[model samples]
Target: MTAPSPTPSIDTLERRFSDFATLGEALDFAATGKRGLNFHDMRGNLARSYPFSEMRSDALEMAYRLIAHGIQPTDRIALVAETGPDFAALFFGCIYAGAWPVPLPLPTSFGGKESYIDQLKVQLQSSDPKILFFPEELSEMAGEAAAQCSVEGIGWTSFADRIALKCELPVQHTDATCYLQYSSGSTRFPHGVAVTHKALLNNLSAHAHGMQLEATDRCVSWLPWYHDMGLVGCFLSVVANQVSTDYMKTEDFARRPLAWLDMISRADGSVISYSPTFGYDICARRISSQTHVSERFQLGHWRLAGNGADMIRPDVMQGFVDAFGEAGFNARAFLPSYGLAEATLAVSIMPPGEGIRVELVEESELTGMPGAPDRPKRYRAIVNCGKAVKDMTIEVRDENGAILPDRAIGKVWCTGPSLMEGYFRDPEATAACMKDGWLDTGDMGYLSDGYIYVVGRAKDMIIINGKNHWPQDIEWAVEQLPGFKSGDIAAFAITNGGEETPAVLVQCRTSDEDERTKLREQIRDKVRSVTGMNCVVELVPPRTLPRTSSGKLSRTKARNLYLSGEIQPYAVAA
Candidate 1:
């Protein structure tokens, strides 16, 4: 057995910017080059170096195995995204076999086994995959979900052992669905987003163009593969753009996040990394406990630090710069982007060299809420979410679908070559969001000077007294208190005494009644400051508030559970 060394950042083969007819075509071209995907262990040591040639070869074999087992074109093949060679090979193998590959999430710490099974079962039922492939470790849980969904489940290792008859792969169409992506928020009624190879390739091309990829660029990621940002931006985009890359398992990143930084520090060339705000938040907090950041990390070469999949938090970005700037991390590397699965991967990306930029606007401008008479005006800093990617047009539309002028906060809509063909097998659901040629992003935002500033998700808005309030504003307010971290709070609207007021459920780890009471008071006062009105605040057990698979706080789920009595807040002593 030999230890693995990572692939080089630059290769001799000519670089092509994802101008391919299909993802398979993209992989075929990339395989001609020496660059490929690298997987790292928990301590940031390279465990496997999977060249694109090897990946394509393994995928061809896997495709043969699937075909020998009666897999057909357009068939949905679900595979648990494990951030390894096996899953990667199987995903591309499905594409080679003319089947639509579906990547599902591995279990998370917040959700227990049953919860995971339920989430998997819902997606399985929705996707109706011909077969579900997962790692051997998750067989117990995946098997149960497969059984419940009445779908066949097989471990990739066992499936790989099957005899694969040598045969030519099926011909693929660019318009045919290349894959099915379920949004991270897809919990109860999951809609499988169907994206064509044309759309996928187009988005990857635009993404590369947006970032202005150079031959010396390399990618580093620890995002979960189930999420669009990870699957498309980190995994597929790298191969399509013919860039070598490094990856740490999402769970490993969660446990030892600084290892992600450690890998980037050791990288010899330009490093391109992406994460949601929470990733930056976690790293910033973790580094505070460690001594001598300069001695550990060398981030001068990290070229693009992409931020997406959640609201961009300038404060968190600033905290990260505060912690690592001494170690050669430049604030200019922050590349904030806005996107969703329906748009393939990216809708808008901040141009390179532009660090975090924010604009302060009054509460009335943001939420349309009327301030108290003679009360001081309140304002919030909204982070600029960048501009639309190539071949994509963004417009803000009011509730009636009429386009709004710049800076008038409204529903954000986008139309582009990369937009998903539609939600797979759910036209009714698809029609609800698709307006003519534009995709109603279901996000509330405003456009100013050709840049977008996303306030938050529209559905997550809390309405009180005919004015709208963002739950994130309330949640962020509570997070300002000591001992609180990101994802520790969930806020939503609740009706009490026939009037709507914000209700917050905060995760309290303290068992002391006095401490819990104090925490509750602190949270209540904080929400009062943000909302300008006193609201209900409850302290629940730690991890009570649910998070989407992508690790964003799920206020909708929390509110439903609280209303249904599933989430019971602790009764603080008087």
Candidate 2:
């Protein structure tokens, strides 16, 4: 057995000089190398490892089996994205079989069975997969969800056994449809973003160039395979560049995040890994709780400590650096980036070695609100997300569709080869985001000397710890209460102690103090049931929430009023 080493002795593979036109070519090139994927358990012990050569061989064989089972080229094959060798082989197998693979999320941190089932059904309906493959452990849930969408569902073991090997693998073109990436926030509703082979390869190439990846570079990731950052940035990018990677499931990392650092410390090569701001916060908090945090981890070789996926918190980044700085961790290793699933992965990445840069601008300037200069001024620290990746162009446009000048925040627009083709079978949704060739990212940000600084989201989406939670979804869950009405609840994000968390303000009618407290607890439980978030539930007087001119509940206005202290809660304890 080959012992696990960060920089194991193996034949060096030649790097691809030219960019691959498709993932197939990329994987074929990677198979020439000795580097591949290494899976690990929560304890940081190696579970299994597969070199690129073995991965490609197994994938090709599985592709033949899938083809023999009448899975036509470009057919939809949905897989429950579990972090294991099965998912690894099946993902590549779909690529080899010329089938468009749709990676669905496993159980999330918050949502329970019903919420997960609802999410699965929505994605299944949107993707319209011909078959859904899941591990045996999740067979009942996956099969039930697949049945709801009228699709065939098979467990991994049965799926492999049932496949025949009488037919040949289908040829995949460079420009063919590669996979469908559904946005994380689309669980309440699903719109499958269609990414082509050319688009994926373009993004992968941009990642390789942006990161300045080298042969000796290794990766450690605990991000879910369903997430774009995990699938493309961590998994596929390494494959394209022939870099070894250590994998821990997202749940595993959630339970024991220090394992990620442990793996990094053991690896005898340069390390590259990325996470959202919350991930850094979680790790820092976990370490703080320990009585005697060891100094065994060596992060001196950690080259790219990336922060992205949601809003980047400078304070959180500082906390992480402070906690690990003594253990050979460098503050300059943090690489703040900005991107979305619609763009395939990265639009902008902080230049290597530049580290985190913050601009402390007046709050009035960012919000376009007039304020007395003589008054105690409030400032917001916006972290620079760096310049656009190779070949990607970014523009900030105002509400009227006119492009804004630099440093003026507006809707972030991007146009690049990595942009998605469109939403699968949903031209209306596609038309809403795509105009001409540019994609409206639905994110608000600004640019200064080519460096991008994201301020907030254009939509009423509350992102807590990198996980997306739609305000409407939270409100709907609360509305299920006996006394609550549809428009009586509002959910939004609030910054507390340098961390962004969800806060729901409810318009209550009753004045009974005990009754109201019970109601507040009920709302919290309901929201938690749906979103898996423990939000600050505040009961406000009726009509406290602002409404748009059309009489619709304006969550933005409500949030603004709450932050400005204009909307006071009644009979509520903070």
Candidate 3:
């Protein structure tokens, strides 16, 4: 947090590489003599390999067909599909045509068709895309929604159809919009994040160089394609690096976590990957199953296991290491990295060989109470998110923008070439976030000895009786209690009118009267012991906690559900 030395000017870097004009050109150069993509559909036992030549050809053909279908250079197209060859074709197709491709989540409502239609209406109103592309299975429903919304120029097409289209012409582009990534739509309305060819290529160059990815590295992931980490981490990074990758559907992985490990082990994947907390808990749960032990899968070959997309949990990491250490997995291979869509994927990666490091501070000091001074406590485990990537700078700053010294908790702000140009079509929001080239990430954390430690989101910080508390800190405390699964707790602040109180919600393993009572007491006592704040605890069934597509808990959604009465509160013990 000390006033960081001045970051090198972007202008200086621009001058250094003035030769390359656009992303397509850079990609064309990078792809030379490199294999592009290897698609593995584990569910269907299908594998398809695309060399760079074929990929470029496919991209160009899709671009020609899109233009023939009346898509203009600046027109917007919305894509609703999972991670697969189709998604890649549509994304690169948009780039080729100089149109913007907006990736949307698969409709998540249990209300069936009507719910999907309503959600589509919201997105259509915000995006106003000229055309919509979806899976053939979803065409009828999407077409009906389009008609219902009175969206013009609607066409039903399959992924195969798009790929089959001939490459009759080539459309040249010097400057054009490539893709549009929508915000998570968690807090407020979602805005599109516009990424250009040049920006994307520059960011990819930085990422490939930072991660030290090689052409022979193979990637296997179950992250959703709609999210930035999924799209960029697994798909784009592999393609940009010209490596082979296998993708498993996220739901499929959730239903059978062991399959993820089986695939990685079978493939002998060099670059096995996932967000931090996901790999840890998934392995911890799966390895304990008798079925998982029968078919032994050695993870010794797995390198560059990444943990990102949410707050990296220390216990989760330790759980993974303890569970898999006997199976030949190295703790040092777990790379706790950081990035956002605005940064075009990865901003910084922890040094490759040094896994994760955790710090323990006196709980009272964190809550702003006058107690024992901070002491270095030995943690059986640590969760270090690594350091900032080369050429990027990170700072912890107070609310007023003044940088704080190391070990002082504050907002995490970053400045780098990979930062987004700005929020698409939202100048005011853009201006608020991007000041003097520094992106206010809204994440809370501190730096200690050149390592980054994320606490929680600034907006998610709970203030009760004049003490600051990170929801993660409380959640961590509750998770350690008996009968609580790791990562099963979510803490958020609930406010009505001008009064605010901290509420703790946990997913319980059992609904038995005695079990429920014990859980409630355990959660309350644990939180109070850690933060000195009395909390109201609610218990729900396992998997009832709200989660984003990528499996990270959504505090915002959980709070909304509580406020709307959709989530019922548990009875407090008298």
Candidate 4:
């Protein structure tokens, strides 16, 4: 288990960012005066490099041409491309032109054209984007989707063609919305998180400073650009700090885990990067298959391996450190972080150079029932996502919006400059989320000694017989038992119509009859032991558990299936 580092004083954080005006200015200054930004496509066999200055100039030119082609400042445009230099150019182009850029994830060609078109239609209907800008390679896919949707216009722009256009537009004020990040919306409808130039600047400045990022650092990442962690954490942060970055295709990394390690090793990337639980598990599995040892990558120099965009698992971190300890990776490089698209990218980051800090308590005590005293237990770890970034304030509050003290688990609320102005044009939703200048994060967690510990989503909390229990607690416990994949467990509550009692649904993998019976018994026993609630354990085949594109388990969809009788519950042994 990694011990906590010395917490830096708030005064230290405040003093560090006293000079920067905004995130855009900080990035512009870095690009022009300090770190000359450079990017490489690690997956490309040709090995082409795109400099930051050239990318910025290309973005400005593209934005100017788009405007010249009748696209207005307030027009919303959709970008459909994989993670690459083209995606970055279109994103920054929108920012320069004061347009909203909605980044859509690239569809799987294997899913067939119909499935792809359906998803694109749903996004277009929801966002009502004025135009769809796509890569020429995806022109066929884009054309099919555009035909199905009611979008006003559709255009294909090649990277070479966009850069070839001539334009000189002066950078404007820092108040315009720079990016429109769509939230994961796991539980409800997705909202566009409007991040302004000023907000982006503030978040990047705070994050870079907190991580001790330098111009000499390089990043190798497989996180997708449509997501906040990939866009801001990997790409924007690299550009803002003026560092070189190498990006690999997310699908390619998924198919070949060792490709991630190979890229980091080849790039000598000092700033190793990722969302929580990804890098650790990949390295653990990949290192096991290696026959020849290579000394090119020094994992120790891979400082600031960030964990965010989801709950940080202790076992994952431990597994990573144990696997790479021989390869010169420092366990202290594991940095658990907290952020959302609502607050740009990062709200709080654990100070770099310090190892991850975690807390252990009886599972029942965390769900509002009295169980045991707070002891420093190292075995069962829940990571601390350190202190709030500079200019941000975090408060844990109850259902009635009353703030709770440290150790009391509740909804995490944040107030900061990096927070979005509001969900675009959705006043009712915005009003519901923003209260007293604090954004209701919808995540459930607690603060102890100023460090935040997340349990689960507030909406995902399961209540049985008047006691509250986080689904993650039950899911984690079940997954730890034999015969379960690392991310295969999902626990949700099913409420029958006209009945108050909501039954629990536990999703796990089992095919053997005896093993399935034993797994069922183990799941029920764990739930009863932890929450004193009897749950219906459903044994499903492998990959039955639904996941978002980024691979986070989808509890809502699983619960819906259980309620609709699409999933059958396993019988307990006599």
Candidate 5:
């Protein structure tokens, strides 16, 4: 028995685009060749490689077994998406069985068991899946959550063991529902984004043409498959193009982020990968502590280092480039893009090789309010996310629904073939966002020269006295302090005595009363100087702030907890 090769080339197949009516067809075509997936361990060692041909056979058999188990066409089956051969085969099996696969997230290390169980139950209730498949380690918790939703839960081994008889598989159509994507509950509760096979294929095809993907392109990823960026961009896109990919579990990457780069560096082929801003931040921090990163990792071959899934931070991108540039990394490799689950994945991607463009706008002008007074005397660097992808239209509209001119911040909306059919079984929620034919993105941004620059979320914008203030601006100001880090503070507007005031919550690590008081004063002063207003500053212990399933700071949740008194502030003695 031989260990899997670190750099395995699977270019025996030709690159195909826009040829498949559904993902099942894409997989069927990919299986005809030898290209497939490789799984890597935590220490950057390959554990297994499952060719698409073998995977298709396993899935086909499993599809018949699912039919024997009484699953019908369009039936929903939830699968805890873990990066392994089991999940890979099961995901394809559900497709072949003509059933919709609802991908759920695994338990995060930061959240305790109760949090994960609650999240799971909420999603299960929303999707109402017929059965849930989970890894053996999480079977107990998955069972508890499934029971709460009145669904059946079984471990992967048990699922395999129950395949007693074979039956004919169902046929899937291009217009049929493909899967349910539950949005990461960052600003609010998670909603299931219903996508169709046509929408999925359209988005994937746009990705191929937009990126100019080639046969030799290799994808290395540790993004959780439950996320749209991971599922569509990394997993499905690679399979559709017959490109080889190396994957490490999201949990493994959290522990050893360098392993992700190790796979890329060890690859003697061109590498394409994407991650949020935090991923780059964590990796840069980890490598800063390492004295020999240059001797160990090679990044010159990293052709497309994509940034998405959240707000792209230019500072973080620069830090990563600086940290790894010595090892043959190029700053131009940074590909900043904009997307959401509602669009089925990417809507706009930076042109190939033109990385991280910034447009400096006057801070006060970002609010787009007429005759607005308070000028912050600062400029905000809004990163250009790039032009809309093929066949996608982006428009910036004012609150009155009128299209705004370029450089005027307004609600971001898009209409495209890749847009979701609607939210699953929630007509009210779907109607609220879908108007006419365009999908209201609920995000605030502006367009300049046909390029989109996202400023902030409309739901999270803090409006005080008719002037718009972004919580990110306030949080970023406080983070300028030497001891502060990203996501260490939360800022929002609070109602006080018939007027709205700014409230800032900071996570302090010090217990010394004087030091705590000094920190609070420093944060207060910084915010005041930036916004020209006095603010309420509360000092809470570190780790008290809340994060989304995808690890983004949840300002709405933070405000709720603070207002509800769930977060107790440190006592400041005079």
Candidate 6:
């Protein structure tokens, strides 16, 4: 039987708003407080409660052990970020040992074993870590990847049993490289973003002030630890801000998403929780009309409902509100944010109580394509991602790097103390994205009245015959067809007989031959309604489309595989 975790109050040590020189100093201060992390099982039962005081002692021991085992300062230690105390202690342990901790993703459900190994091997090759630390259960896969990379692999459980000697920890400055963060979905051509202690601390401080995090505020998260939103926002931010947090493993959340809400509801104070659009979408879809929301959840204390890590969907937000409104879920708690790994996490955050906002922009404007007189004007709802964070200046720039005026769509660029030093060991790739201390966030968005509305990634735009078409517009339209959901369709531009045309790869689940053909036509018609041009729609098997590490549809990979004939489409009868 598991015991309930105690609620940490602010009566003991005063909250310091992350006003520290380094993360080590931040942890040193937080160790004096009662706030800590509480992890729950799949059923939302308390599994383990780890306080900062105990974790500090464990981290110090682990740090000494690393040094005693020949680990040196500035060495990179790859960690498979599992949702447990071992990962928590080892992550900070790497920092205390003056080594850069690289958080890697665990194997997801959709990808097969070899696929998972390939992804891990590539990342390990990029980071070239001195050692790989992972949970004992994943030793087989982690060991294979480590062997392929010629790096030592050690499970933290066994490593903890090793002898530790008390020795002087290396002195760390604010500018020292704290860690290397590979952006979500960076398995191919991965470029690790090296972040400094000052940058991480600055961003953590910005969060405390931006959200106006209250004393009674606690956090609940089901996000994976490798993604920036999960790492910098929920985990590291929780530590640097000295706030108690409840965590449900990402896998557990996938199996039983409602358990996330249960944990949040069980907490006694104001709750600050986050999820992408898909997370909200699943929860809203889980409950039926007959199910009583109040009987299961008491969400009145959830003050800050954060939305990010993917495109924010107003429809999904509305669905969630409609489902849980009767149970005290407020619409105003929605917080849409904009960020990237290169920025170290948050670039802009919507103010509290602002909720989700949108603007209907011409489809041509969003795609950077000139409108044709013969075609009807169409519009897409672009969500407002809110104002830039403190010290982070955002600008819309043209292809020539010239700044654009308000509401003029262009490449999104940001520069601030929160930005990374550079892509580790990849100067050429770093130079391509950074200029004059500003990071060119390949996303295209416009600013209006101090609020930013992100359109889409410029690379994902499909240009054919001098007109640009956004894959999202076509994909969203196709998703409206029955039996389809988000990420079921991938749209991109393909070259056919020396001519460019839009190609759509949709995952068709229907087994009947006639139904599959009809479904393909339905998707084609739906896409044509959005693009105003004929599109080649291929009906592939379900789960055939590729997804990023963050579970986002990867149109680029989909296109590559489709063109290379790796993804086979079913034959439709004439």
Q: Pick by lDDT: which candidate is best?
A: 1
Candidate 5 on 1-574: residue-level lDDT in tens? 8766533464556679856998999999988887788898899788988887878888887787788888888889999999888888888889999999999988755346765787788788889899999999997899899988889998977777765466766778999999998865421245789999999999988888888786678889998888888899989888777778889998898899988888899875788988888788888988755567779889998999998866676888898988898889888988888888899988999998999899887755764433335634657678999889988999999999999998888999999999999999989989999998899998999999999999867777664422345677778778989899998999987757634578999999988999988888888888766555678899999999999999999987887788767899998886
Each model's lDDT comes to 0.87, 0.85, 0.67, 0.67, 0.83, 0.86
lDDT of 6 by residue, 298-350 (tens): 99889999988766778789999999998899999999998888899999999
- Ranked by lDDT, the better of candidates 5 and 6 is 6
Q: Residue 507: error of model 4 in Å? A: 15
Clashing pairs for model 1 are: none
Instruction: State the weakest 10-residue window (summed lDDT) of model 1.
Output: 461-470
Local accuracy of candidate 4 as per-residue lDDT tens digits, 1-574: 4531211111111123313444445444444532333333444221445666667777777777677666677678888857766777777777666677888767653435654666576666667787787777777877777766867445555433643455554455677777677753221245677777788878877887777765346677777777788878877776665566666777676676666666665554366576546556665766654533345345667777888876676776787777777767788888889888888888888988777787886555544433335644223356899889888999999888899998988999999888898887678888988887889988889999888888766677564421235676667556666766456777776534422232445555555678767767777776565445566666665566677788888787776666546666665556
Misplaced by over 4 Å in model 1 are 461-573
lDDT of 3 by residue, 1-574 (tens): 3431211111111111212445445446434544445554555233665655566666667787787777777788887756666767777777677777787666542336654665566666677888777777777677776777667523335444653455444454534556777654321245567776556666666666666764346677787787788876677665555555666777676677767776767663366576547546866866664534434767887787888876666667777878777767889888888777887777777887788777776544343334334644322222567788766789999989999998897889998766777777779878978899898887778888888777656666564422346677678778778767656888898644433567888887675788788777777877766565677788876677788899888887787677657777666556
Residue range 240-303, candidate 2, lDDT tens digits:
7778888888888988988888888877678898998888888787776452444667889999
For model 6, which pairs clash?
A: none
Please list all clashing residue pairs in model 5, or write none if there are none.
Answer: none
Residues 1-574, candidate 1: write the lDDT tens digits.
8887788898999999889999999999999989999999999999999999999999999999999999999889999999999999999999999998999988866446876898799899999998999999999999999989988999999998988788988998988899999876545557788999999999999999999998889999998888888999999999999999999998898799999999999887899999888788888888765578999999999999998876676778899999999999999999999988889999999999998999998876765556667889877788998999999999999998899998899999999999998998899988988977889988899999999999866787664422345677677778779888888988887757634578988888889888888887888877665455578988898878888899877777888789767899998685
Question: All candidates' TM-scores?
Answer: 0.83, 0.95, 0.73, 0.74, 0.82, 0.83
RMSD of each: 9.0, 2.2, 12.1, 11.1, 9.3, 9.0
Off by over 4 Å in 6: 1-4, 7-9, 461-571
lDDT (0-100) at residue 62 of candidate 1? Answer: 97
Residue 198 shift from truth in candidate 1, angstroms = 0.5
TM-score of 5: 0.82
